[model samples]
Target: MPSHPNYSNQGNKFAPAKTSLREAGDLYGQKEFHIYQNAIEKMRAHDDQLPSLPIITLEIRKATSNPNVNLNHLSSLIAKDPSLTAILMKHASSVFYRTADKPKNLQDVIKRLGMGAIESLTLSHSIKSLFVLRNHQLKALYKQAWQRQTLKACMSYHLAKTLHFPNPEDAIVASLLSEVGTLALLSSLQDYAAPAAPTYKILCQHYSKHLGAILLAKWGVSPVFVDVLRKTGAWTLDTGRLLQLVDVINLGLFHTIHYLQPQNDLIPLQEIAAFKKLNPQYAMIKQQKLLIIEENISHILQLQKNFE
Candidate 1:
C-alpha cells in the first residue's frame, strides 16, 4: 500500500497511554495541582490594565447601542494606543477591504469602514499582542497557532452574518478570545514546549474548565460571554445565534490545524461530530474547509512579516 503523504511513519512520540477521563480528572485532583491553581490565582490578582487604548469591548457596545456614537469618538479612543491605531490603519488599506488609498486619519478610517470591519481589525490587533514568544521555534509555533485563531474569527464572523445573527461583531470577538485561556496557560507554564508535546495537548484538554473558572474569578469578562464559551461544547444554540456560530467555527478551525486527526491520544472526533450536527453549514462545506484554513494562514503570515 502506498504511504499516505500526510501520515508519518514515526511512532507516536507524543501519544499518552490509555487513560480514562475519570483518571485524567484524578490527575488534577492531586495535591500538586494546586501549584497551577495558585499561579493562576496570582496572575489574576494583578489588575489587567486596559491596553493604552480602548478595547473592542467599549467600541462595539457603544456603536451598537448608540447610533449617535460618532466616528471622532471611536477614532480618538483608538488613537490612544499607537500600535493598535497602526494596525487599524493597515487593515483599512489591506486588500481584504480594498481601501488601497489608505485613509489619512482615524476619523476617515471609521467613516469609510463600518463598525463590524473596524471591530474585526481591532480584535485581530488585540489578539496578536496578547502572547509573545521569546524563542524562534516557539515563535513559529505561536505564529501558526495564531493563524488558526484568525481563521476561526473570520469563519465565525461570516457564519454569524449568514445566520442573520444580531451581533456578528460580538461573535468575532468571542471567537478571538475563546482560546485566550489556552494561550494564558501556555504563556505562564515555562516547562511546556510547542509543535509536538503531549503535555501541551493535556493542557488544552483541561483548559476550558480550568481557565474558565480562573477567568471568571479573576478577569471581569462578562458573565454572559463566559457562559457562551463554557457551554460551547454542548452545542447549545439557546445561548444565541452568534455564539452558536462561534462554536462551529472553533470546531472547524481546530480540526483543520490538527489535520483532522487525533493528537496526543486525544480523540476530537466526537467534538467535531457534535459541532457538525449543530451547524449543518459547516458539515456541507467540510471538503473546502482546508482551503479556507490555508488562505488564512498565508494572510496572517504576511501580516506578521509587516509587523516585524
Candidate 2:
C-alpha cells in the first residue's frame, strides 16, 4: 500500500480514538492536541447530527432509478429547488457542453446533460450545503474544502469517461464525498472557537477519513463509497485487480495536490499505485495523462464554479 508522505504514519485503517489522539499530540503540538481531541469527542457524541442527504436529492434519485422515468417529472422535481435549477441551466451553457444553440430551459438542460450528469450535479449541489459554516475562519477552510472536492469531482468525471468506465457518475460521487468527514467536523464547530489554521488542517488529516466513512454509512450510501472514503490517501493501495472508483479518486487527488493545487510536499505520479494501474489501462504516456487534465481544466473550472 502506498502511503501519503504526510498521512501514512497514522497507519492504515481508522485508529482507535485514544491512539489517534496520542498520535495527534505527537504530530501536532501538545497545545493543539486537546482541541483536536475535544472536536473528535464532540463529533462522536453528536453522531446523529451529521448531515443527511436532502429529501429532494433522495426523490431525484428514486425517480431517476425508474427505467421509464419522465424527464418532465424530473425537471419539476429539480425545479422545486430554484437554486439547483439555476445551476443546471448554467452548466448546460458552459463551454464544456456548448453546442451552437444553448439549452433553452430546465427540461432542455436535463436532456443536454443526460441523467448521469444531472444526478451527479444534483448530488454535488446538495453536498455543498453541508459545507456552509458561520465561523469566520472555518468558513475559509470550508471554502477550500469545497473547491478541492469539486476539483476532484471534475478530474474524476473526466478520467472515468476517458478510461471508458461503465458509470462516470460513480467517480463523481466518490470524489464529491471524499472529504465528507472534514465537513462533518466543521459542521460540529458552529459554536466552538475555531482552531488556528495549521491545527485545523492537522485535525482534518488525522480524522476526516474515519469520520466520513461513519457518516456515509449512517446515511446509507453504497458500501463502495464508504470503503472509498475510509481508504482515502492510501496512494499505493493496490486492490491487485482492475481499476475501480478508488483508483479514479486517487488519480484525482494526485492531480489536485501535485498539479491543480500545487502543494509543497509533492509526490511523483509514478509512485502512485492508482496512476500505475490506471495509466496503462488508458495506454497514455505520462504527459498525455496530464494533457487530458490540462485540456479540460477550464471546463472543469467552469463546472466547479457553476456547481457553487
Candidate 3:
C-alpha cells in the first residue's frame, strides 16, 4: 500500500465512529464487537449487486506509466459507448473549452479539447452511465450525486492549477471518480427498500465501508484514488497537495451553496479549517475562480441540453 507523503501518523479517529455506524448494535453499550460484526454480515448480504461494467484492468495498468496515449485510440475506445460519446462532445463544447463554434462530431470535439480533458470526461460519463437506477427516489439520489461530482470536477481543475500539481487534468479525472463506490451501491438499491429522503451523510456512512472495497476490486481504480477517497474527510499537514486542493474545492462549494441558500446543509467547521490551511489565499482568489469554473460547467450542461 503506497501511502501519500502527508498521510503518515494521521490516526483514524473516524474509524471508531465507522465501527459504531456499521454495527447498528448498542453502539454504546455493546460488551463485545460481535453484535457489530453480525450487522456487517447482514449488510453484506444485501449489498451484492455491484456496478455492471467489466473491470478495465488493462487500462488501469497502462494509465500509470503512459497516460498520454494517442488521442484517436482513446476516442475510439470512448466512441464505443454512445452515452459516453455524447458526454464528451458536450464537455468539449462547454464553456470550459471556450470554442467559438460547437463541435459537429465526436472526433472534432476530442481534437478540440485534447486528450487530458477527454479522459476526465470519459471517466465521469462512464461511471454515471454504467449503473442504471430507474426509481424516482434513486433518480433523485443520482441527480444529487452528479451535482456533487460536477462541482468536484470543476473545483479539481481549478485546485490543481493552484497547487501546481504535475497533471491537473489527471487530478480532475481522479476527483470525478473518487466516490464511484457510492454509485455502485446506489445502482443496486432497487434490491432493497431504503428510507426516503436520505441525507448524503447517512447514505455514505451506511455504505462506504463495504462499497469502497468492492468498487476498488470491481472497477480497477488506481490505488492512489482509493486512498484519497478513504481519507477525504481527514485533515493533516501532509494530505498531499492535490488532495488538499480537492478538500478546499469541496468546502468552497459547500460554503458557496450555504451562503446562497441559508436552508442548505451547514458547512462543517473542520472543512473550513482544512480549506483555509490548504489555500491561505483562497479568500483572495475564490470569487473569480468560481465564476470561471461555474461558467464552464454551465456551458457543458447547456450543451448537453441542446443534444437532448
Candidate 4:
C-alpha cells in the first residue's frame, strides 16, 4: 500500500520517496524503537543525563509528606524561589479557589493552597526544566506535551475534589507524573533529531509506561504514584471495590483526551469502567461531568496564562 510520506527535516517538503507507507512507518518506528529502548536502558544503568528531580521539589515533597507540616517553614522554602512564590500567589487568588479575598502574602498563599495542593503546584512549576532541549521542533513538541500533562493533572485534582475523594492532591501528582516517560523519550529524541509526529506519538504510547515506571522508581516516588504511570489510559481499569487515585487518574486522562480532541472516538464516560465505579458514589458526576470538565478547562487555561 502507498503510505504517507515521512518528511525529513532537511528535505524538500513535497519530495516523494520510494519507501512504502508500511516501510516508512517501520523505518521510523524501528529508529525510535531503538531510541526509546536506549533511553530506558540508560535509566536502568543509572548513567542517563535525564533531569534529576529538583531539590526544592524534593524538600516540598518531604515537608508535605509529614502530617505536621509547618506552613510557615513551607512558605519560607517556596518564597526562596521568587517565581514559584508568584505562581503560588497567583494560583491562590485564582477564581478556582473561590476565595473572597486575595492572599496577603506568601504564607497566606501557602495556607490557602494547603500542603497537598502546594506540593502538586510546586512540582508542576518545576517539571518543565526537566525536559528542556535545544532542538526547536522537539522542544515545541515537549512544551505541548507538558501543557497537556498539566491540564490533565488539574483535571484529576478537580475530579477528585468533585467526587470527594480523600486525597485529591495525590491525583494531581500522579496525573502530572503520568507523562514522565513521554517527556523522557522526547528528551532522548533531541540527539536523534525530530521524528515525524505520528512516529514519536507511537513510540510514546508503546513504551512510555515502562520507561516512566523505571524513572519514577529511581526517583524514590511512591509505588502508588508509580502505578499511576502503568494504569494511565487503561479505560477498563477496575481497582478493587473503592475508587482510588488511579481511577481518578484514568478518568482525568479520559477527559483530557476528550477535551483536546472532542471528535476523537474514545469510549464514552458512561461506558468506561472507571466512571461506572464513580457513578454509584457520585451520581452528580454523570450529570455534571461536562460542567466539571468545562470548569477544569477554564482553570487550565488560566494556569497556563499565569505560569507561561
Off by over 4 Å in 2: 1-32, 260-263, 279-289
Best by TM-score: 2
Tally clashes: model 4: 1
Give a tens-digit lDDT track for model 1, residues 1-308: 11111111111322234445676577557655555545544544552521222355456545634667777677777777788777667756655445557688888777665776676566546656766656565566465556555555555554455555676656655665565555555455433334234334444564434553464445455565565465544432344433354465455444334542334333344434434444454344343343334445455344434333
Which residue pairs show collisions in model 2? 2-236
Q: Better model by lDDT, 2 or 4? A: 2
TM-score, predicted candidate 4 vs. hidden true structure: 0.82
Tens-digit per-residue lDDT, 187-300, candidate 3: 655444443332223344555445655666566666766665665544433554444544654443443343334343334444444455544444343432334344445543
**Which residue pairs in model 1 clash with each other?**
none
For candidate 1, report its TM-score.
Answer: 0.61
How displaced is residue 155 in candidate 4, in Å?
A: 1.5
Give Cα-based local distance difference scores for all models: 0.51, 0.71, 0.50, 0.68
Scored by lDDT, model 4 comes in at 0.68
Model 4 per-residue lDDT tens digits across residues 1-308:
11211111101111122444576467554756676556545654563566778888899889988998787888778878888888888878886685678889877887787887888778777766677788998887777776677767777877888888766777767887777776776776676667665455445545566666667876777788887777767677677777788888877777776666554446667777677775654534533255666645776667556556
Report the lDDT tens digits of candidate 2 across residue range 1-308. Answer: 11122331122112112234465456555755576567676776677767778899999888877778898899889999999999889878987678999887888998888887788778878888865678887687677667667777778877888888887868878887777777777777766677655455566665676677777877677888877776667878776677888888877776766544343344566777777775544545454246677767777777678766
Evaluated at residue 292, the lDDT of candidate 1 is 38
TM-score of each: 0.61, 0.84, 0.65, 0.82
